[model samples]
Target: MARMFRVLGFFTLVIALMSFAGDLTEMSLLFFVQTVVFFLLGYLNFTEKTYILLFWAYMVLSFLGFTYWTVFRMGLPF
Candidate 1:
């Protein structure tokens, strides 16, 4: 799933660049952060830790970042 997230984030980042409707710079930044989060998630997911606290943190950050930037910044009903 983390790999999937990185792939999707990269895809969206490219879309944002080509579309040129939304704030491409901001979109690209958010997607980049998301890609990092996904990479971390992949690492943590594969680890043998007793708790996935970092996983939750990554989830929250990625969710809120994507939503805030996309919805209120670049996407519909902003």
Candidate 2:
């Protein structure tokens, strides 16, 4: 599980770099924060089930945030 978190942190760091290169500062910052969080979590000694639950919570929150941003923040006609 810790290894998985570190992998995710690496992936997010890549994403953050890409976003920065693309001039998406806000997105870059968001991913940068996530990278830090994942790295921190990776160093912690947590149980596998806890890690799984945390990942699930992250997924749910991210999906909901993305949906909200696309639907409401984007201002597209319904």
Task: Write one digit per residue (lDDT tens) for candidate 2, span 1-78.
Answer: 899999999999999999999999999999999999999999997999999999999999999999999989998895
TM-score quality measure for candidate 1 = 0.39
Steric clash count of candidate 2: 0
What range of 10 consecutive residues in model 2 has the weakest lDDT sum? 69-78
Range of the 10 consecutive residues with the lowest summed lDDT in candidate 1: 43-52
Task: Give candidate 2's error at residue 62 in angstroms.
Answer: 0.2
> What's the number of clashes in each of the models?
0, 0
TM per model?
0.39, 0.95
Full-model lDDT, candidate 1: 0.61
User: In model 1, how large is the Cα lDDT of residue 4?
Assistant: 54
The parts of candidate 1 lying over 4 Å away from their true place are: 1-23, 46-78
> Across residues 1-78, which tens digit of lDDT does each residue of candidate 1 receive?
445545655675576565456756766666666556555555554543422555566669779977898888796962
Q: Rate the local accuracy (lDDT) of all candidates.
A: 0.61, 0.98
Instruction: Report the error of model 1 at residue 41, Å.
Output: 0.3
